[model samples]
Structures are given as structure tokens and as C-alpha cells.
Target chain A: MPGRGLNLTDLSYFPGCSLESSARESNISMMEAAEILGLNLIELEDWNCCGSSSANILDKEIAFSLAVRNLSLAPPDRPLMAMCPRCLYHLREAHQRLKEEPETLRAQERRWGRPISLGLSIIHFLEVLVRLGPARLQQGLVRNLNGLKFVPYYGCTLFRPPSLRQGSYYQGEMGNVLTMLGGVPLDKALTQRCCGSFLSAARADVVTPLVNEILASAVAAGAECLVTSCAMCQLNLEIRCTWEPRLPIFHFSEILALALGAQDYEGWFTRHLVDPRPLLQARELIP
Target chain B: MNPPAPALNLRGAASPIVLAEQDRYLARDIERLSRANLSRCFHCRSCGNGCPFIRGMDYPPNGIIRLVQYGLRRQALESHTIWICVGCHTCSVQCPMGIDIAAIMATLRRLALAEGAMIAETNILDFHREVLQSIKQYGRAHKLGIMLRYKARVRQWFADLDVGLRMLAKRKMDLKASRVKAIGEITRLFIPHWKR
Candidate 1:
């Protein structure tokens, strides 16, 4: 319903492991929202894992090589965009390392039998939205959020790491983008709290209290819900909280697509663990 | 319930840490590997205060730095602090000294694994192993498979069965893994030759 005649822009998208499997709703809604915004997110061919936190912990060599393999798969024409913050961090970190050590880059290129593009730009979906400007977003907006209050949760990986300090910081871009869509951003909450991450699987006891604290903060701030850019944060916050009247955790794209009046939202909303439909229905944004 | 134990007397006790047994190069090696300045940490405790999992860690982030600075190689490598960290970088961003505390923790974890130091938390290590195993086998993580293998390894099948079932009900965790067509490229990375 929005951006009916805008020229489409092509982007190479890396969904990573979480988005590809556990967070498929995020992937679908993100693609749907991008389509409305006239952004073509093409999947990279034969892409592998980003050598996640586990790989990075166990062996540095394997982690670097795994991330580099994805880099080799990305086409050099358009920028490579990722929805998952961890995947983006690993890819950019590997690229940074490769930039510093030309010999290692050459070795990786030789091993993969494909030339790794040193000039290829690695960007997040937030960066892409920011680059597209508020005017395009405003033009694409169909259903105004009707003053929906939400805590913009950027869980740990997007902009905190020291290795990524030199890169573009997207700390408040979520609030900025959501604000243009008539949503109220609640900044009083623990917006940058580390969402237990991989520890949720190994140590739920440690994660439960943390997730509860974050949700409690959002509740205390008078926020009706929480929006997060990372898929893992969405999953962790939804499943880890033991408190009653749990706040609905939304993937940033779901909210964005809903604003753009995407017709296939039922498919996406059905997959959410904490049902967001009640909140949407109450807001009168959806029927 | 018959006899009471006699009171023990303490006069002088030797400390467990002998200053002469310290590994002086421990700090330097960690700094080199992690590229973080260990000397910059003045025990500010900014990292520990901001750490979400500080309660889970035996020593605070700065305390681990203190252990490494003191050249307590065995203690530093064997401490629960390194294993408890999930590398969220909350400490790194909050550090006024520009020290990447998470990177230091990551380096310590690698060193601990390499030196065969006793892992403080075997369950966490087992989880990492399962995740890496899933990546190696399918090139992409299969959530169901990883969870099953991890639960099996930890020998706790019903630990988070509720959460697992909820995810299953929502179809969040797929039954089959999405595989990479060029699987050889991924499997090779797990081998030792890829390092060179």
C-alpha cells in the first residue's frame, strides 16, 4: 500500500542461522517490508554460518575462515546486509582482520577459490533504512502506529563491541525510524542491556533474572511492548521471562511491515511465541 | 553424636600463591592475543558494575584482569569469570580505560581450552561444542538438533522442556537443518589445515 512507484534497490542479504531457521518469521516480514520500501534483498548463494560465538570461543582460525567464506560468497556489486547483529559483527570483524593482514586475506581467497572483495561494504538493515532517509519511510508509511509505546531494544552486538567502534554506530536509529511511523520510543528502559545471548541455552537460571529485569524496566517505563533488531534478543526475551503479563517482543521488521500495511502479516504473527495480535488489535492497527 | 572435635590452633600459615612461581609472560601473551591493554585496567569496576551476568561470574571482569596482571596463569585460566562471559561487550563499552574486557575474557577462554585448564562450567562448554558440531555438520545451525545434542551431553533432558515445547509449538525450531550446498568448504574450516 506504500511506496507504489519508487524505484527498487538491490541488496545482498545474509539471513544468518537464526533468521534462516528459528526466526523465519523475522526473515519473511523483513523481506515483505523491504519489498514495500522497494528494496530487493537477494539471498547470497551457498552462504554458511558466521562462525558464531561458539566457534569464536573454541577456535579463532575456524571462526575467521567461516566468516570469510560468507564474504567470498557475497557479490561485490551491492552492499551485503544482515538482519542479525552477531552475523553482521562477525562478518565485519573478519573483514577488519582481513584488511589489516593482506597475507591472510590472500590465503583465504586462495582457499575459497574466489576473490574476496576488500571494497565490499557490509551494512545492517538499520543502516540501510537510515540511508534510505526518513522521507522514503514516511512516504511508505500506511498505518500510523497511533502513539504505540515501545522500548527500542538493541541487544549488545549492534554497536557496543570495541572492534566495531570505528564503524557506523546505530544506537538510536531504531527509535528515530520508529518515531517517524508515529510510534513513541521509550528510552527510560534498559535499551542496551545484554540479552543473556548463548548463555540462555546453557544457563537459563542466569538469563531468567536478566530478561525479567529488562521486561520490568520496559513495564515501569509505561511501554506496552518492546522492539528489538536482533532475532536472538527477540527469542531470549520471549522465552526467558517467567513474569506474568509478559510484554510482546517484536522483531523490528514486523512492526515496520505492519506500518506499511503488509497483507501477509498473519503468517508472520502466528509464528511469534508471545502473541502480538492482541496488542495490534487493541491498537486498532489490525483487524 | 558421641564425641566433640578438639579445637584447631593456627600460628603461621604459608600462602597458597608463591610469588616466585608466577608466570610473568601470562599477561603479555594475553595482551598480544586479545590486543587489549591489560595494564590500562586500574580496577575501576565499571565493567563488573555494568555486567548483567556478574552474579554468575566468580571474579568480576577487573578481578580477572587483576589475576592475569598478577601473573596467576593457572588461576586466570581456571577462573569461572572467563567461562561465564558471553562476550556481550557490555564491559568493553563501559570501560573508561578503552580496554576490551570481553576480548580479554575470550582470549582467556581460548587459553584455558588450549592449556587443558579445568573449565569452571562444563555445561556451557558442552553447549558451545554442540553448536559448533551443528555448524560443522550442516554449515548452518539446526536449533532442534543442537538443543537435543546439548541436552544429551549435559544429561538434563527436562531442564527447559517447557521453553523447548513452546518453541516447537510456535514452529520456531525447525525439524530439519538448512544445509549449505558447498558443504566441503564449511567442513574444511573445522580441520586443522585451514588454520595455516
Candidate 2:
């Protein structure tokens, strides 16, 4: 149970829709965090959507099939890890649906031209990191963000069609990891509130106010910065900042990487909407 | 092995809080709200702890769950709080509650709106639902379609132009395709979700 002593040798990783686009930080930082924790992420052999997108609103099968396809691609031994709530939602939800309805599973298998072995486990990156623990985390920090008030923005995936209770669950220790890394993890709200995931583009009108509500919490909590485990939530919260808190939103892993002593904050942290320089400058974590 | 019967603890109604006048312990439809299996919530506050909107709302998501458990029906339904819910539902995944706070929210939103709790500021939310419905109708969110409909109804019509340009420049918003290719074809392949 300790560190899962999990080998990085191979596994399928579902980075989610936004990871490739808006939330690249999760991707980059996860890489950094993985380095510190000694976990190797083998990108899945082949992948597609995790299914829970506005794209799936009209087509349920698109979301389910894509997730099934991704889950099916993982070799029998390695579990699949996903970073997006929606991806996790689709993949995990599909797993539950399949678990309950074997006939539905067979139909999809016949339709998609693939066989989904019912034995595979779908996991989240945050869950994996938590399982690995703070000892493994100690080796990951490049610099400790001592002064920044790191607030974790969880948003929708925390509760949804793919309920956390349903499958391989990840604990909310995402914030604990930040606090352990020598930063202030504010206990605040809207962490799991909606960041207007599907609404970001498809429904930008709803996105503004809903996202504003989340930002208001981070700002009011006196957080100098924010961190998140999900890629989509970060996208909404970062791009929609009004007063420009100038607080950089970080991927959970990136923060861990920084604390474990990673020197490349520029390459790692530079690509954010709300310039994290203020948080970094105030802390002297970087030159 | 026997599954844990859906648990219920409504003893709080004996107290004087008027919000508990109704059977608050029992959600209007517990079957739906409990889909995430909130019985699993250990109160670790992972979702609320991680929520970006933790400071603004009167009740964080976890508080809402506690409110639901206490049978504070009027309060939960009357909440302008859930109106601000952005539908992100991260608490569902992070939650040890494994509670689908998001789905509960979705149910709450329907109840809230039906019960008239969502009447505060119609501009943002109405347009938000409209956009989602448009995508639901078209199998994709055509940016131009979503934008025009949103602006026309909100009356500021074009006030969000700066945002559109920024997103487009960033490639976050697209102009060409109506839906992701093959979506309509695949959507019809699933089991029918019967509307009760």
C-alpha cells in the first residue's frame, strides 16, 4: 500500500480534452511531478475522448464509445489514469454502466469493433499521486512556494455522473500535498463548484458568472494563487479572471514539482493566463 | 453480500429551524441525487476544499449536502446559492462521498427553476441553458449560433465580443464545424435515455 511502489513502466493516461489545449499546465506539471515522485507515465497506445463533453450531449454513444475505446487500449496489467473530470466522468461512468449492464457492453463491443475487457481499472492522476504519499513528494519540489496562498479549484468532476464513490477513487489530498509543500492551502468553497466546464465555449454566457463566482472565492480567500487537479476547471477559472489577481493557477503536480526542487519554473510555470509572477515574486521562490 | 440500504437520518426536524418544516432528510427525489452515492461522503471537503468558488457562495457544495441531509428542503430549493453553481461537479470525483454533487446540483437546478428559485438574474443563466440546449439540439455548439442567441436574449447582445475574439485568437472557440464529425451518427447508437 505504501507508495503503491507503482512502477512507471507502462499504463494508459487520459489527459482529457482541455489538457491538450487550455490546460497544458496539468500535462507539463504532471510530467514534472511524475519525475519527482519517480512515476513513469506511458501515454496510452491509442486514445480518444473520455466521452463527457458538450459534444456528447447530443450523442451519448460518442462519449461512451470513445471512453470504452481508450479503456480497451490499455494493456491488461496497467491501470488507466485520467486528469480531466469529464474524461474521468465518461470513462468512469461508462465503467459503471458496463458493470451494471453487460448487454450494453456487448453491443458497444460489436459496434466499435473492439473488445473491452471488464477487468481494467480507470484512475485519476491526483488519486495516484495521493496513493504515492508525501515522502515520494518530498523528492519532487524544486522550490517551495512559501508565501503564495494556494487554493485548490476542484469544480464539477468532484460530483457528477461519474461519482467519485463509483470506481477507483482519489482522495481530496490534492490540497494536502500543496500544504505539505510549504504553501498555504486555504480551506475555501467553489473548489468543487462548477467552473462552467462544457459551458466555457458552448455556453460562454453562463460561463462568465459561474466562473466569476469561483474566482471570487479564490480572491476573497486572500489566495495569492490557485491550484487544481482538473484541466477544464483550470481553463475556466484562469481565462475568466476579472480583477486580474495575477495569481497563476497550477496543476497539482506542477506545484509538487516546484516544491521538490525543479529549477525550471519559467518553462514550467510561464504558460498561464493570469501571470503567476506576482505570486512567485512575493515569495522569492524564483529569482 | 447485502448492499447498504440507502441510509436516511431525518431527526433534525424536531428542532426549531423553519427550513426543516418539510422532510428535508429525504430529497424530493433521493434516487437521482444519490446517484453519486453521497452516502460515501466522509466530509473530507475535498470538493469544497478544491472548489475555486468556495469564497463567493453562501454555502459551499458540501454544506449543501449537509443541508440536504438535514431535510432543509425550502432552503436548498430556495437557494440562490445553487443558482451560482457552474455545473463543474469536481466534488463528485474528489469526494470520498463519491456523491454526485454535480448531478444533485443538476436535479437541484431543475427543482430550483421549476419552483422559481432561479429567477434572480436571468441574463447569464437563461442564456447559459439556452446555449446548452442549442448544442443538445444540434449535436454541437456552433459558436456563431451560441453567440448570436446569447447576445440577442441578454440585450447587451454584443458586449462579449472581446471575449470571443480572445478565445478565437487562442483557438479556444471555433468558427467552422457545427458538431464534431461523426457525433450525430454515434449519438443515435446508444440506449434511449427515457425522460420521466
Candidate 3:
């Protein structure tokens, strides 16, 4: 609400693979939130996988090419908005690399069968929310989550390597969003910790400890729930950790949707491994 | 009674510090391939300390950089560190030298696959392959297909059976692969580029 009249009319959305599958709740909540904000989310047509954590590790060219394919599909005028941090990072990195190396871009253009343009900006949903301002968000809140102490978890992808970070390194935008929703945002040290990412698929043993440490730190900070932007982070954090008295992990969009008076938000909770409804009911946010 | 082993000669001999010519070439090759200035690393353990997966790695981040500097390509490529990186970019951000350690790790992984270097963690490699194969078939990742292929390849179908079942019950698993209309375009991108 920093800017009283500022409004985002429409944005090109890129819901990565996880959003279409495992993180369907995130997609639902994001669409619902967009509706409340009077924002039109225009999903990029024929957008393929960004070739995130896996593609770059296997082959750099494939990663770049895969992301370029998606980039080529975005509308030339509007900036592309992504929900998943990994996809956002890959798209941004690919854009940067394409700008740096025109030859690579030309090669990809030939493969993609189109003239590639690097002018289209790639923005994360978190950044969009921050730019929308907490004041604006507060104006639209139907329910006040005053007592809910939430920790904003910004797993690795959002702010790293210094180049890809949009705003502050820590997810201050998430905190602003929580604050706007009348939720207490807890300041925790491990907010930017790694959730072991794709390691969960190959070596859950290595991921378990990292996930435990993140959860323990959040609980120690007296958080009622954890909010994050990354779908993979949510999946790894929720599925990998099985401690007694588990903290419910909710995507930032889900909370925003709930605050914006989305009735069917409860349906999304059923997919969670750690049930978050109990926590919501305890806060009297849900009846 | 065990026989005593002979003592090694303590006399002056050629030191084992001789650098192989191939090692130097390998070091230069890694530098060119990763586009990271190997000389920039001052042996700072920042990358190693910041890496969450370092404990499970045969060679830590700094150790890998050192190996690259020393032109020990085989040791560096074969280290489980490259495969276990998880691509979190923690080390890359933490490095004081501003070197993208994660990018270097990616380069090493690609080199490992292409050069037929020994892979310490076959499961990680298999997982990547399965994911890429899924992407190649469909425009996007087909979760069920990828998981099934991965399980078949690794022969660990029951590794996370309960989790798989739970996901299925929650309707998180997609039964079919999604294909983009321009599937032929994606295929063209892969066929020529990756086939090398």
C-alpha cells in the first residue's frame, strides 16, 4: 500500500512443473489471490520446463535451451511472472546468459524455430507482491490473522549468487505480505537456509538433517506456521521432516488467498503431509 | 606371529611433488569449461563451510577447487561432491572470491558424464538421466513416468513406497505426461545439442 493508486492489471504467469503437479495448491491459491487483487494472471502459452536443479547439473546447454524455450513463449510486452523460485532463477539466469552470449541465443533460436528476444523480463511472484505493497494488500484483507506468528522461509533459489536477487536477500517481501494479512512475521536466522532441494530425490538422508534444522529453528523462534515461495522447498520441508509437533508449511500465496477470503482454501490443505488446518482453526481463521 | 614389514628408505630421492603435464592441461581445461578463474580461489574454506551437502562429499568444495588447480581431473570429476551438490547455489553465494562454485560443480558433472569418469553416486546420475528423458518425451516433466523410470533404473521401486502412495492418495501424482504442441521443437533442441 506504499503507493495508493499503484495496481498491476495483468501479468504473464509461468507455473513450473511442480506447480502443475505436486504444488497444485500453490497454483490454486495464486490464481485466487490474483483474483482478489484485481490482477489478471496470463499464463505463458506452451511454456515448457525450466530445466531447473536437474538440467543445469546434467548439461548446461540443455538447461539454457530448455529455459529459452519457455522464454520464447512469453508475451513480448509483459514481464513473465513465475511462482516457483527454481524456475524463476533458471529463467533469469538463462536470460542473463543469453544476453551475454548472443551466439548461444542464436543457436537456441534455431532449435526453438523462432527469433528469441531477451527483452522480456522474468519476475517472481514474491517480487510482484512486494511491489504491490503491504498497504494495498491490507486494504483487501477480509480476515485479520493477528495472532498467527509466521516465519517466512526463503529456501535457496530466490536470493543467491547476488545476481538473481530482485530485492533484499532475505524474503522481506513475504514478511510484508504476512504483516499486511495481520499475521506476525517472526525474524529467524535460518530463513535463507537450504532445504536440500533435489537431494531429497537421490539422498534423503542428507536432506533430513537440513530440513530438521530449518524446522527446529522456526519452532524455536516461536512460529505458528512457516510460509515460503518455493514449491520444492515446501515439498522437501513438509515431506522430509516427521518430527512430533510439526509446524505447518503454507505457501505465501495460500495465506494471501485465505486473507483475501477464499473459501475453498481448505481443499488445498488436504494435500499437505503435515495438516495445517488444525493450526488455522486454532487461530479461528477457519470455521 | 606376524612378519615385520621392511622400512622404506629415508635417503634423499625425487620428491612426489612433480606435476604431470596432463594435470596442468586438465586444470586449464576445467578453467575454460567452467569459465571460473581457478586462480581466484585463495583456498578459502568458505564454500566448503557453507555447503550443506559437504559432510557427505568425498572432497569438499574448496578441496574440489584445489584439485582443479592441481589438475587432478579424475579425482575431481569422480568425487561424489559434484553429484551431491543439489544445485542450491549456497557455495556460489558464500564464496568471497565471487566465483560461482555451483557453476563449476555443474561443469564438472557434465565433464564426468561426457568423459566416462567414475561416478561415485550412480543413483544421482540415474535420477538426472530419468528426469531429462522424461522432459525429452514430454514438453514438461511427467512425475509418474519419471519416478517409474527412475525406480526401474535404480531398482529401488520400494524406496519411498509409502510417500509415493501418500502422494497418489492426495492426487498430487499426474497419471499422464503433458506434451506441448511444439514438441518437435524441443526434440530438435535436444537431439542435436545433447547427442554430442
List the candidate 2 regions with Cα displacement exceeding 4 Å: A1-9, A159-162, A167-171, A202-206, A244-246, A267-270, B1-159, B168-196
Question: Which candidate wins on TM-score?
Answer: 1
**With candidate 3 superimposed using the best TM-score fit, by how many Å does residue B17's alpha carbon deviate from the native?**
6.9
lDDT of 2 by residue, A1-287 (tens): 21254553455676654565445556777776676677778777535445544434334455566567666667757777777766776777777778789898888777656778677777777777666767776655557667568787765565444444654444457777777778887867567666666445434555677667767787788877778777666766767656554467777766777777766767655566566766677688767
Q: Is the docking of candidate 1 incorrect, acceptable, medium or high quality?
A: medium
Total backbone collisions, model 2: 46
Model 1 local distance difference test score: 0.89
* DockQ-best of 1 and 2: 1
The residue-level lDDT of candidate 3 at B15 comes to 22
Candidates in descending DockQ order? 1, 3, 2
Displacement of the residue A272 alpha carbon in candidate 1, Å: 1.5
> Model 3 chain B, poorest ten-residue lDDT window?
B6-15
RMSD of 1: 5.3
Clashing pairs in 3: A1-A133, A1-A135, A1-A136
**Model 3 CA lDDT for position B159:** 90
| Whole-model Cα lDDT of every candidate shown, in order | 0.89, 0.62, 0.81
